[model samples]
Target: MSDMANNDLEKYAKALDNAIMKYHGLKMEEVNDTMRHLWNKTYQGTDIDGIKIRSDVEGGASKRSYNYRVVMTKDQVEMDMRGRCSAGQKMLASIIIRLALSDSFGQNCGILALDEPTNALDVENIDALAESLVDIINERKNHSNFQLIIITHDENFLRKLGQAEVMEYYWRVSRDSRQKSVIERQRFR
Candidate 1:
């Protein structure tokens, strides 16, 4: 890469780093730890193996990888992203990365919209994820202007969330007889 290209790349990286720290109030080390923590919580059982975040800069171009695998008895096979992991695993990883990179490069918006966030997760995993999200929100509540809005049809997941004061924030979307979408906010606490 040319000097100009390298300069631009560095500038972008620096800006991204600044935003991440400013918004999330977490250092790079903390970010890694958070990722690992979330990953472990998300994949707590069964054949799903391990996860590793790798950064490599060969020559000029650079890349990052979220390497994960399935630990079988005879052989452990590395997944090619769209290769082996289940839907829930993929969704969990995506959420972790999205939250971790909550800088200008990612979703720095004050609002986080998760459509059917617990789609493929099992009961235990869903509960785990809900608890983790609540922890994250509480930790960052006074620090940033961020909110998590989850749209899911799973009643069990909603109960697992256990958001006590969610009455003011929760909303229900439904279709009327005309098939028009109608949004109803929670009227009871």
Candidate 2:
């Protein structure tokens, strides 16, 4: 189209990129701090201090795309998480990332849901996760609209989680003889 229009589009694109970069930078900082605090003993000899983002911006103006490589350090050794990490490590990292994302953007939505968060985690890691989630729940318990919904089949985990904040009951979902879904609220004693 016109040169003026092109220039305006370029400016808008740059602005968008700047906003995204700023948000990512802040989110990464939060992730780093949280990872440090939530490091689990089950993670083996490696302590994940933090994660750095290696991002490249490409393409023109409105068509720009950002390529990112999440660089994680294990015991001071730098490596890409996709390259080498156990299932439990990966799961914990995934949870940390989601928590960071929620902290960054969940204010507007005010709801966070976790499905099988304890899956693939060791006993120590499960305990750590339960404590971490309890801390989060306590932090958000005062918020009028904020809600954390956890879905899992681990009864022990539920008990561990409920010990801190009693919800009185939890919903049990099952199937009837006709295969219809049934949701019943069962109290925790």
How would you encode candidate 1's per-residue C-alpha lDDT over 1-189 as one tens digit per residue?
699999998999988866854654344445556566766666555665544344332342244233333221212654445566778877776777666556333445767777788888877778888877777777667657677778899877776565644324567789999999999875433
Candidate lDDT scores, in order, read 0.64, 0.75
lDDT of candidate 2 over 82-117, digit per residue (tens): 867778877877887677667766777879888998
Model 2 clash tally, residue pairs: 0
The estimated TM-scores of all candidates read 0.64, 0.77
- How accurate locally is residue 41 in candidate 1, as Cα lDDT from 0 to 100? 69
**Best by the TM-score measure:** 2
**Candidate 1 clashing pairs, residues 3+ apart or interchain:** none
Report the alpha-carbon TM-score of model 2 versus the true structure.
0.77
